[model samples]
Target: MPIPERFLDELMARTDIVDLVSESVRLTKKGSSYWGCCPFHSEKTPSFHVVPDRQIYKCFGCGKGGGAINFVMELENLSFWDAVSVLAKRAGMTMPESFGGSPDAQKRREKMLELNRRAALAFHRWLYAPEGAHGLDYLRRRGLSPGTLTRFGLGFAPDTWDALIQEMAKQGYDKRDLLDAGLAVSNKDGRIYDRFRNRVIFPIIDVRGGVIGFGGRVMDDSTPKYLNSPDTPVYNKSRNIFALNIAKKSKAGRVILTEGYMDTIALHQAGFDNAVASLGTSLTEEHAQLLSRYFKDAILSYDGDGAGIAAAQRAIPILEKAGLKVRVLRVTGAKDPDEFIKTHGRDAFARLLDKSENQVDYRLAQLQSKFDLTDDAQKVAFLQEAAQLIAARPSAVEREIYGGHAAQMAGITSESMAQEVSRALRHRLRKEKKQQERRDLAPAAQLQPKARSLRYDNIRSARAEEGVLRLLLLDPALLSRMDDLEGQEFSSPLLGRAFDALRGQAQQGLSPNLASLAQIFTGEEMDHLAQVASQPESAANGPRALTDYISIIRGEGLRRSQEQGDDLLLAMQKKYQKSKAYMEEKP
Candidate 1:
């Protein structure tokens, strides 16, 4: 069996949704709902609303809506059960004993987490031990200090295969666990070896501070000098950040994003406490959203290599799209932060951070350096690309400022550049709109479907049942009145069952929580219920709204009765006659 509804009911009754969501959002009461700028996306105006009555939330801006459970699931990147456990812990409730999960799955997850923890400890221990002497020598060669090495949890993977595998097994870890953790690999000969060797290690942790995996930098010249943990049960490269666990603790909301672990440690050692890195991967939208929860701004500090500059350029729009105030830190005279910090003292690196340039200025500067303003054709090419990037800005004021900068850089009039920028923005918007339309029209396989819908229904009947259930979810007070309608004729069986379940719980002094309701539905049914529950309604205000909803359901029920006509009347009469005949025959 899945998690029992009764358990969820107790959990919700104990946990308050308003208190849970208010931690991340600056919610203010507006009419019947609490509205705030969505934490999930960038928007100046608030489109995220929390309805106290329904214990549900919706962001019109990003189209993300769900109950409190959904918010935690997305924000923390937790599975549904894990999210439920988090909330239950916060609410001081124990997870139900009847909750079902595959023991094999649990074992796999536990094994991976355990291996990562052990590997991190081993790496940290190696950083200071005699065996780590060579790794220590390598870091010093790279201009790292003892403080920097310890601070970043840098460790060494020995050159010999099976070193870590053997060490772990002696500590009681199994080969299967090591493989699942991405720390070990099996060869054709059926022998397992360490994934990283003769390398300095950097552990990758999730936002919640669990060690998910590691990234390694070779101590000497080698093919693919950097090695990282493959995607596994605990880590996804696109979704994890290297140093976010520590960086999020910084007083500054802004985070300095780098390309590698060394860059992150170097920046941090130089007093840029908010610096973090992607785990040897390109920037991703998941990373952007994750960062947005902690900060409002980002500074992209990529390497100065040709490939690095191109990667930064590619990432600019993605950061902007996520509504972050993005700036690019172009380090010159050195290839990366580690090198820059070494070549010049920490003060020089600090100066560079202080001089970070916005996207428009950075692009314009890069283009100005590339193309001759004296050459008309090159200037035009520069203007076209710069305009496309500048026009994507959400604020017109900022766009105009960048336009003026462009004019100054190209030796043209601000008015001309502004017109060009406007035209480019319109073109970009049209292109995006058309793309979105295509996305909407594409086959379901091409896109992740929004939860699937239940079969077509008589709109009126579905509406009535949906309204009653939604109201019941919002107001515990209305749960008592629902008992009167038990076993009554209902148009939607699922909706009826949901109602009866709530009423049954209410008689036992229980509250129906969103997670419990989730347990009641499966597949398409669950999707349909999520959509229905996420509906925005004004009737979410106080007891009167609940009463009004109950009235609407009753009215709809009566209307449905009238539509059945004389056949319905005949059936009732026949049932009554049969009951009387049965009594006479018994005597």
Candidate 2:
């Protein structure tokens, strides 16, 4: 059974939306609503708004809007019920005995987590067993002490199929559970086997200390050297980083972002506990936001290779957008941190980290390497590119400082470099203004759902539907005015479903707010509904406007039915004509 609607209503009533959101976002009052930068997506100017009266928050920039429950769900990356439970706890309310959302889904998530834990433990035990000698030797050779291995819960998968499969079976988990947990793989002909074999295992634990997934590295030269868990019910590789569970607790103020699990583990073993790595993927904006939560600064300690350089170049803007001070660690004399520390000692690596270059200088140096400054034309080209880069700096002061550096590198005057940067900035601003103008010209396009999957097929009917929803949500007393309308009449199925849900709540004498509808609506649906609610709807003219909206919706619905009927009739007539022609020819 799901939690009662009354319980959710009470929970939301006790939890203030502003108080919940203000903890993560720095909100300042502007008129009746509070505004702040959206934490869900990075932004410079504040576009996220919180309306205390409505008990909802919306980001005009990202189109993410919902009540308190949605805020917690998006900010913490939690499921709906989990988010509700968090608010319930904060409000000092006891949860109903029944689960909030789908019991089956919740059960499966818990089961997957348990299976992952059991698998992690089994792998750890196998590391010390005779079957894992080779894997153990590999880690030991990499300078991982037993204590460090234990600290990270590092393990080994034996060099045989069905080893983990058999172990999990004994632990009361079936092959299906193992597969769901990403601990086993299924091949053609219905054969099931372990996913990791003859490899060193790294358990990817969440910040909450749950074993969500695993990463394994082969002990020999293999075609695919590293293997990670596929996205499961409990794990998304893009949203998680290796060793962040421990790294978040480090006293060090900055995080050393590495490229692989081995590099992260090596850094941790060398006493830099604040190191983390992306899980077999390039650093993503989501990863940058996750890093920003714990640290004010991020040092990109990628491998000193072409791929590493390119990755750092791509990550600089993303990290900066997330409001983190970014630096690049130039690992000299070695290809990666693991090898660098092994060859030059930890002290030298620490010194290198201390002297890490800011992203501006690093990017400038990278640009300089692409051209021959001795050639006058190439020198001019280099300066042009450098000006564009420097112009992208958010601060005028930063642009000026970096412009001087670029001028020195190209042997040009600082004043000339500043002028070039100013021109580039003007060009960028004009491009942005033109794009904004295009968006303004198509105001209806801006009103469309941000997710393409939820687009409106009938703009005319959808506009009326939006008006009806906005009025009903803003004024629950207007529910009586919607007696002539039905949710199924709306042009968009998503909007129809929302209308039905909200109408049902209002009929039952419950407040038809986003919080009340959150349990029934998915996050995306809630976001769209919030967008509808955020639209301009005049309360003073609510009754008249609602009546007009309702009439328009019904009229549009009737017109659509007529059009569809005409099309069907035409199709039937064409078929009859063809059949008649065939009959005449046969006669």
Candidate 3:
């Protein structure tokens, strides 16, 4: 059964959007709303606004917005019911016995989680069994202690293909479920088999400690050294990292990001509990945001090879953009963290961590390696690139400090480096200013939906439809003034569907709010609705404005139905004049 509308209304009323969003985003009061950098996307300016009056948030930069539930959904990467449950817990309300959403969807999600859990247990047991002797020998040889192996729920897949499939079947899970959970794969001959045969398994648990997926590493050199779970109903590799479940509670105060699961395990074993790694992928913006929620700083402990250095360079801006203070670790005399810890012992590894360089210095050192300081031309080339890098620093103090280091390295005066950086900064500013000017010249572009798939085809009709939605959201009672209109009258299908949904709620004596409508709308649709609600709508003139909007919509619907090409331009001009006249009266 679906959650009752009355219960949702009360839940939304009890939950404060400001308090919920403020926990993750630092918000500052700006007029009637609170503003902050968007968590959904990286932005320097405060384009994310939380409107306490409407109990919703809208990000002008990313075009993501919704009520508290939607905020939880986006920020936490949870489904609708899961997000609702989170908000319910926060508001101290008991979830209804049967939560809302498709029962099949909920069942499939629960089944996948349960199947992963069972498979993890089976794999763990197998690691200690005779069939997993090879896998066990590999981990022990790498200096992993028995307790460390157990703590991470480390396991081993037997060499045979159907070990997991057979084990799951005995537990009432079929081949289909195994495939859905990413535990098995199918071949061309219509045969199904395990996906992680002859590999040591690492269970990928979420922050909440649910086994959502798995990562497997081969004992010997293979074509693909590691195999990770494909994206499933419960797991997305780009959005999750290895060992974050344990790392989130670390008192170490920062996360040490490595490249592979073994390095993360080794660090944890050596008492650095905050170590994490991406699951067979490079660092992503989502990964950065997720890490930022737990740690304010991150140290990149990627390998010392060319690929690792390139990866670190790619990750620096993403982490910085997500508001994490980033530093780079250079593991000398060792290829990776696992090897470094094993060779020099834990204390020496700790010393290396303590001496990790900030991203600017690391980047400068990397650049220095590429050019010969003895050659004046190469030195000048190096300084030019260094000036651009230093100029990109958000802090003037950082730019000035790093500028001096680059100057000394190239045998130039500090003032000379500063001047070059200043020039670069000026060029960047001019470029940004011109871009802003272009945007300002096309003011209508800002009014369009951020998602290209949702853009309005008929601008004149969409504008009127937006006004109708804004007014209705401001005052559901104004829905009565829309008696002669129908949702199908709106030109845009998305807007029409929104109109129908909101009208249905108001007509049914329910408050027409985003929370009430969320169950029926997609995330993008909810974002668009929240954007509409955030727009200025006059309460006193809502009834009058609504009447005008309805006229425009109905007239457009009739004109569109007629398919008269000759009169199309004339009708559009008339609508424009009417809209212009209404806008002029708004003062």
Candidate 4:
């Protein structure tokens, strides 16, 4: 069931759209509104605007506009109910009864959460038991303190087929609950068993302190040394970062992204509290988005091996796309952060973190590794790659700084390097421009509108109808005078559909704001509608302007119909003349 209208209104009122967005985006005050880079897409400049006066935000770059709750839903990847709950909690408001979310869904999620909590506790208990001594000793050998163990809910999954299964079953949870929580797995004969065993358990927690899932590492050398839970209804690994629950509270202004659980734990143990790792998966855009909510800068501390370098290469664009200032932490004389910290004390590691190179320099260094600069062909290849990287930098100052370094590395004059980079930059710009022109010329969208409420055959009526919709979106109260306008009257079906939705809302005495209307439209459609509303120009006289818009829409329809009639009449006249000529020939 949906939330009550009154409660939704109150929720939106309590939530400040600016505060909510500023958590992720860096907003700057401009006139009466706030502007920032669009979090939904990659752009060099700020286009996402928040108009506090209207209680709305719109990204002029990507066309995403909505209110506070809607923004939460989009940014956090939460459902409407979840977004509302987050806001309500922050606002210190109570949900009126079970108006918070669907009763069934809430109940199921609670059950799964309960099961996971119980399982995590059970694993923790087992770590100290006689059978779990091996895992406990392994933690000790890794230099993990007892306090750190408890802090992270570090435990041991017993090395038995039915250990967790029986333990959870004894706690009154059935096999179904275990499976639903991703705590146990079933085999071909329907024999349910533990999914994790003979491994030290690390609970993967969310920012809300919920044990969403678990990560387990083997006590000894094993084929699959590390294992993580599958995506469950309550836990999605793609959007989750291990240790983020604690990391977000750190005084450190930036987050250190590592490759694994042990590395993150080691960093935290060493007083570098702002450390997190992805759960047994490569870095994703969603991960970057999640990270951007906490910190402005991210120092990726992936291992210094080939795979680690490659991973960093892939992560740069994603992190940049998510609008995080990225730097790469390359460890020397050690395999990973854990080993590096262990070899050199916390002070040394901290110094290395402070001295970490930006991703551009890191990649250029990596590219330099591939070439023998003494060889002519290899040096040429090295310089070209360096030029491409240097050309992509938007700042001429940065280009010169990095260009000088590249020139020094290539043993060439800085002036020659500058010319090369500029040439590459111009060539790249031309290529991108041509590509944009091709894309603009092609109607590349695959969504074929099946109804007139989408698009239409007649261009003139579509344009006029779009104007009417644009007008209605800007001023919902204008819908009162639109009683005479049928949705079918608009030439473009999408405009008509939007008009009908607006009229319906006005009839119901509801506010047809972007957030509410978003409930009726898909994200894409909502963005399009919001784009229409974001247009600044409007009429001073409301009713007169609406009447004019309606007249234009209706007149275009009539004009197209008359044009069709003329075309039909011309066809008939030509047929009649041909018949007359045939008759004369017969005579």
Candidate 5:
């Protein structure tokens, strides 16, 4: 059931958007408003604003804006209803007791969380029981202290299909719920069983410290040695790092990103608590952006092998794009962090961390290793590849410093190398220009970024439609000024949808503000709404300004239809001028 409007009103009343956002983003007092780096998009400057009087936050960069609840939904990735429930809990208000029936997405999430907690408890107990003796012995042999095991919530699943299923059932959970939580798999015959059997379980935790999923390592020589929980309603593997829930709390300003759970566990047990790893996958853009939100630096400590080198190379651009200071950890005497920590001990590994090289140095070294500079042809080839790398640097100073190093290595002058790099930079710019030109040739492509759609036959019509929406948001009664404009008259679907929402609200005698519309729009749409609503306006000029905007919108509409024939376009405009139901649809 939907929550009561009064409750939501009270919830917002109790919540200060500036206080809520300040918990994550470092917002500074700027005049009457607060400002910070936008959470929605990557930017070096502060464009995100929180206005207390309006109780709305808007990012001028990515254009996302809304009240405190919408901020929570976007940042925490919760549903509108779920965000309300969370705020209700934080405010110490009870959910409406009569609001029970079937489970909504939020309720299902709560159930899944409870189920995972119980499953973790049962698995942890089983690791110490007689049935789990083999797993216990294995961990002991690997030198895992009792405290380390408890800290990580390490567990063992029995080598039977029904072990966890039967245990969870005894705790009042249904079999279907377990399957939905990705704890059990159903066969072709519809017989359900536990997903992980006879394996050591490592719980994957979110930054909030909830057990979202599990990663299992087989006890014996099994095929596909590691198995992870698939994407459930609660667990998305790509968005989380294995130990970030713990590492995010560390005083260390940087995080050590590794490959597997065991490597991360080993680093933590060895006093490197800031280490984290992805679950059975390579680094991703999501992972990079997530890490970017917390730490300014990341030390990638993948295995010291061929594949690991390639992986780190691929990950460098992604992490850099997310605005992180990245360095590569070169492990020696062992393949991975786990092996290195075991073989060299903690102090030696600490020395390696201090000696880690920045990404540019690592890349140059890797490329240099591929060629011997003594060969003239090979030196030219090396300089060409190295020049491209130098050209990719965002700063001219950085390119000069790194470019000189490359030039020296190739036994040439730095000025020669700079010329080569400059040529590459120009070539890259030209390529980008051509690609953008090709996109401009397609009218739909030009409209995609603005309208978030390509249905607009003309750019002028789309811009006018955008202007109309902005004016309506600023003064909702401007909607009355647009009584002759049909929802279908807007070329962009987003504008059309916004018009429809405004018409519905005006019809019902409720003012539709960003707060009221937060539940209705997607996060991107909210950003656009925020950007539009942020446009400077005045009450004195609102009506006259709205009339001008409406004229332009209608004029553009007629112009777009003129190719069909001027007579038809004029007749349509004449009818629209006299039309009263243009703001709403007729039955």
Candidate 6:
């Protein structure tokens, strides 16, 4: 069953979209909206905009536009109803008594989480016993102290086949639970065997510290050295980090991002408390968004190999999209974070952290090392990629400075590099425009109609009126005095309707919460309104807030009537003038 609309409404009402999104993507105010590199796609430039006044987000590049519920649905890959349930639970709502999935589905999901938790504990226990001697010895040789191993919940998998299967059975967990948790594999012969064997296990924990799954590395010099658990009910590789449980507690606004669990452990143990690693996957948008939440800055401390540089490059766009200030840390004389910490010690590693470069700086250095600046043809080829990278920064000043550096490096004129950067920017914009056009051309699309669309300037006027309404509704004592709306006037039809709704609800002793009003309008309408209402109004205006509001609202009403070619606006003005004249004469 779909979650009740009223329940969903209440959820949106209680939640701040900025707070909700900021918990994933680190957002900074840009003009009237928030801009970040989109977590939904790989992009050098930030085109994702969240207009909180309207409770909607739109990525100009990906064309993914929707409200809070849509964000949860896309981010979690949940159905609309399931996403609603998540928000409802967050809002402390009981879901309107009768809605959502069957009790059986909920029970099955809970069972899967229990099974995974049990398996993680079992693996940890095995690491200490004699059966896990080889794996334990391997960890010790790698310089993992007992405290370090225990901090990450490092464990061992017995080499013997079916050990996990038998162990799970002893705990009274069914074979189905093992399969559901991705801890065991069933053969054609119908025998289940442990998926992880003779390996040192690293349990992957979510921000909540739940053991979602595990990543196992072989003790021997085996090919395909690592094995990660498949997606289960409670765990998804795309949405998890290896050490977020610890990193989230750190005071540092900077996080050291590594590629593997061991590297993360070494850094953390060496006193770089904000180290985190991806869960056996390439850095994903979800990872970027998650990190951006806790830290404003991140330093890429990956291995100093060809593969490592490639991985860092891939991660840069994702991190940028999450609105994180990124820097690449080159750990000289060391292969990885673990090696660097061992050789240089924590104090030296901290110095390296201070020397980290921004994404553009690192990219230029990394690319310049490979490209032959002496060769004119190679320089031209290099400029193509470099220009594209520089074009991604939103600030015009930053782009010009980088363009000059690129010009100097290539021994070309600054004007020439500037032209190339402009060309690249235009090409990207055109491509995005074409994609948006295609989406609009789709059969099921509801392309925005110009009339109802709120322009940037209209946003301010609409917001002023909304602020008055929200303040009045939030404080019931102010509602009774709202009769003298001296200067309060709605800017757009949506705001006018919203104000009317608020007034009616207040008169009937009903709460005029924004979330309840969201269900009554289109997503675009809600987004515009939210941005307006949540945004800070003119601070210089002072007590004129009421006066300016009435002017905007009455003007909008007259403007709408004029657009319709109606004489009602004129008649209303005449009636008002006549009433004022008669009142003066009687007095």
lDDT values of the candidates? Answer: 0.73, 0.85, 0.87, 0.79, 0.79, 0.73
- What overall lDDT, based on C-alpha atoms, would model 3 receive against the true structure? 0.87
Instruction: Evaluate residue 107 in candidate 1 and report its C-alpha lDDT on the 0 to 100 scale.
Output: 51
What would the per-residue lDDT of candidate 5 be over residues 186-270, giving only the tens digit for each residue?
9999999999999998988888878899999986787779999999877887777899999988888899998888888889999
Instruction: Give the CA lDDT, 0 to 100, for residue 495 in model 3.
Output: 85
Task: RMSD for all candidates, in order, please.
Answer: 6.1, 9.7, 4.7, 8.3, 5.1, 8.3
Q: Which wins on TM-score, candidate 2 or candidate 5?
A: 5
Model 4 agreement with the true structure over 165-253: per-residue lDDT tens digits:
88877879888888888888988998888899889999999888888899989877776988999998678888889999999998899
Worst-scoring 10-residue span by lDDT in model 4: 444-453
TM-score of model 3 vs. true structure: 0.85
Worst-scoring 10-residue span by lDDT in model 2: 578-587
State the lDDT of candidate 1 residue by residue for 340-434, as single tens digits. 88789788977887799888788778777888878999999888877887897778998999989988888899999999999999998999999
Q: What is the lDDT of residue 126 in candidate 3?
A: 98
List residue ranges in candidate 6 displaced over 4 A.
1-22, 25-74, 79-100, 383-385, 411-587
List runs of model 1 lying over 4 Å from the truth: 22-46, 98-108, 128-130, 367-378, 424-452, 476-497, 522-531, 534-587
TM-score of 6: 0.69
| Candidate 2 local lDDT, 1-587, one digit each (tens) | 66787788788779889888876676889888898878888765788888887788888888899999898888767777777777888999986745536556656887898888888999999999998888899999988999999999999998899998888888888888888888889989889999998889999998879999999999888858999999997899988888888998999999999988888989999999999999889988888877776787999998778898999999999998887899999887888888989999999999999999999999999999999999999999999999999998889999999999999999989999999999999999999999999989999887689888899988888999988877778888887656546777789998888888778778877777787677778888888888787766788888777766766676666666666788755654554345344434431
RMSD of candidate 2 to the true fold?
9.7
TM-score against native, each model: 0.83, 0.81, 0.85, 0.86, 0.83, 0.69
For model 6, residues 1-587, the per-residue Cα lDDT tens digits are: 64444455457777777777776665779876797766666555677788766566777666655668767766666545555666778878665436534444555666776777788888889989999888888888989899988888899999888888888899888777888889888999998778898888998877866777889998767866999999976788988888998999899888889988888888888887899988878999878867766887889988878999999999987787666789998888887768877888878888888988778978887878879989988888899989998997788898899998888888899999999999999998899999989977863323222234544235545555666765654454455434434332355566667677666655666555544553455555654554444444543433345444545555555555566555787864554455344434431
Residue 163 in candidate 6, Cα distance off native in Å: 2.2
Pick by TM-score: which candidate is best?
Answer: 4
- Span of 10 residues, lowest total lDDT, candidate 5: 578-587
Worst 10 residues of 6 by lDDT: 443-452
